[model samples]
Target chain A: MAEISFQLLLLQLMTGLALGAIYALLAVGLSLIFGMLTVVNFAHGAFFMVGAFLGVYFLGLTGSFWFSLVLTPLAVGAIGLLCERFLVRPLYGRGIDYPLLLTFGLSYVMIESMRVLFGLEGVPTSVPAELKGVVDLGIGSFPTYRLFLIVATAVIIGALWLFIEKTRYGLIIRAGSRDPEIVRILGVDIARVWLIVFGIGTAIAGLSGLLAAPTRAVNAEMGIPVLAESFVVTVVGGMGSLPGAVVAGLLVGVVFSMTSLFAPEYAELSIFVLMAVVLLVRPQGLFGKAGLMG
Target chain B: MSNAILSVRDLNAWYDRSHVVQGISFDVNAGEVVTLMGRNGAGKTSTLRSIMGMLDKRAGSVVFNGQEILATPAFSRFHAGLAFVPEDRRIVPGLTVRENLQLGLIASRARDTTDAMIDEIAQTFPRLKERLSQEGTSLSGGEQQMLAIARAMMAKPRMILMDEPSEGVMPVLVDEMFELFARMKRNGVTILLVEQNVERALSITDRAYILDQGRIVHQGTAAELLADDEIQSKYCAV
Candidate 1:
């Protein structure tokens, strides 16, 4: 066995945290959609893939990473809004299964459409010069982009928390998540709220995808693995709980990273293991209310 | 008929094939507190819900302010100035008392004046004023009920359809709620209340209707209903 140094462990921990941040971003969006709309968005991963492709398209057009970063989420979010209006809205009150199935099918359509338009090959994104290279920590050196990812995600999550906890629309979203019928009776156009929530949820997912592009391949099938892993994060955190998604995401990320360092083969398997243990121990997830899904 | 703010004619409603409100008819005049008193499952709540457009299957001529609203959606019905305070007093979890009150103005024309409206409403319910920052659901049962009523008032509604506000509340708070209703009546706000506390409800009501098995079995002035103990025991028995 190779001797592990303290610096190496710290580096692995930082890497894990960065990975976890991305997972948290994706998982939180999933949780928000589920919480507000009560629809399991199978199309989330596809939205992520769309974001990356949009990033590639926009970056190629402007040769500016910043432009792609700003444009991808807006474009993808608009797509999400349209989807909510046309696809998801019709299926509500018909029961959860119809929307679930509709989104399941929607994911396939998104993936196939991307494949047809962009071709089957994976696209690569180069990190911006300002964010490239390594920064020296007292313990060791870490990539600036990775640190930037962590900071950017933290800022975005903070903003999202403020939106949900402080703003009036956020109040509606929170109340609507708990009892949509009551919110409706209060004269809120609940349909509009759902539309905006889907837009916001997919917009965040799109942002995460763009952020992931420099580190991971941008391909038609790219969202598949991330999608599966995010579902684990969401379940472990508890469905429909925002804070739960964030905490569980980071935990899963660190666990996966540590496993990757110690036993490379078990890295992916470890996420499932963690999920299974959490389910057996606390079925509602760490922050999820009991019987919410039911 | 001209003075009636809410006029219901042959209102029928169902809950998944079980007809809950069978052709129930009633009229609530402007600036008067009207009560619908009944036993459990007597369709009192159903009648209110149907008027509020909450029931999916219903047939009725519900003319609110002279506009037939049976075909409009629940939210639109609210936009037409019909506020409903449900029986459960659903104080939303994870929301503060201030936020709970904010829910009342979310879709109202008064939404732009949220803080001012809250301050104005807080003066009336002193209990809620002290706990504006506290989570709404964490409050005691009575406080939650107050929050629900205060929330409905935030809409600045022309009429309020209150469902069992006195249910599950402390006797002291029940008295407070009735007192508030009396004050609202004095201020010229129309009210249609569904209550299990027959005597307390009748004390403040102008007229009372007793429902039995989805139909109106008795309708009379509050004084007449209060004097008739036989009608109360026969229809509103626990």
Candidate 2:
């Protein structure tokens, strides 16, 4: 039997946290879309992939990382907004199943379109000059880009939290998620709210894609595994709970990282086991309210 | 017709294919409390919802402040000085009382004056004043009804369409709510009310319309409706 090493565990923990940050970003967006619109957006992964490609294209056009970072989400958000207004809006009141099926089809279209445009090979993303080095911690050294990703993700999540908690629109969103019929009767333009929510959710997914570009090999098939992973994180976190998504993301990331360190074969399997345990014990997910699942 | 603040001409409403409110017509003058009284499923609630543009399959004319509004949507009707307080008293969960009131303000393009409106609402409903920070779902049944009314008042509406304000409320709160309605009428806010409590509704309303099945069977002064026990027995059982 191999002896446990504290140093190795610490390194693995750091990697897990970094990976969890990305998952949290993806899962929170999914939760918001599901909570507010009740649409299981299978197209979310495609949105992320498109965002990565857009980020690369925007960088090529502008030669500025800052511009791509800002523009990628906006561009993807517009597409999402259009989709909501034209496509998803009609499916509402028909049933939940229609939107789910529509999004599934949308995902296939996005993937195929990207394959046609970007070709079959994975695109490489270069780390910016300032972030292309090692950061020396007191105990160890780590890549600066990885550290930047962790910090950037934290800042983004914090900002998102503040927006949802403190803003007028956020209050409406929270209330609407529970009872939209009441919200509509109160004289609110519920159609507009739905559009904005879907847009924001897709934008965040796209932003995650852009953020992941430098860390992963960007290809047509990249979105599938990540989409499945995001679903696991969302379910484990308690569907539609922002804080739940954050906690579960980090937990899943750490567990996957730690498992890979010890038994590489069981790395992916660990996430499913945690999900199964959460399901058996608390079917509502970690932070989901009781009686809300139906 | 010219003096009336709200006029409904042959108003019809439906839930999908089910024609619920059939040819219901009524009118309310400015600053008057008008009641629509009926038994269960007599289309009284459907009449109110149709006037507010809440029912998509609704047809016929709703003229508020003398502008034809049959073509208007629900939210747009709100901006035109109409407010609706439904029977359910839909208090949003996870939102404080103050936040719920804020939603009312958002509905009628009254968001900019939220602070002053909130202060007025607090002053109007003393029961809601102390519990402004409490989650809306935590309130008692009567208090929740009061909050729903107070929320509608946030719009500073010219008129309010209320559906069964007395439902599930204690007698004391119901009396208090009627008194509040009287006070609102005195202050120049018109009301179109729906109620199952025929006796209590007659005491406060100037005029009453008794609906049967899906149409208005009787319309008269509140005193006339109260005095005519025969009309009451035919349309309203209680």
Q: What is the TM-score of each candidate against the true structure?
A: 0.97, 0.97
**Per-model DockQ against the true two-chain complex:** 0.87, 0.68
**Residue A263 miss distance in model 1 (angstroms):** 1.3
Instruction: Residues A96-162, candidate 2: write the lDDT tens digits.
Output: 8999999999988989988999998957788766778888765478778878878988998998888
Task: Give the CAPRI class of candidate 2.
Answer: medium
Model 1 TM-score relative to the real fold: 0.97
The alpha-carbon deviation from the true structure for residue B58 of candidate 2, after best TM-score superposition, in angstroms, is 1.4
- The Cα error of candidate 1 at residue B7, in Å, is 1.2
Number of the top-ranking candidate, with lDDT as the measure: 1
Kindly list the per-residue Cα lDDT of model 2 for residues B18-86, writing each as its tens digit: 889999788899989999987888998888888877788888888899799887767777778888899
Q: Model 1's lDDT to the true fold?
A: 0.92
**Local error of candidate 2 at A135, Å?**
1.5
Distance from true location, Cα of A18 in model 1, Å: 1.5
- In model 2, which regions exceed 4 Å deviation? none
Please tell me the TM-score of chain B in candidate 1 relative to the true structure's chain B.
Answer: 0.98
Q: Candidate 1 on B6-78: residue-level lDDT in tens?
A: 9999999999999999998889999989999889999999999999888999997999998999978889988
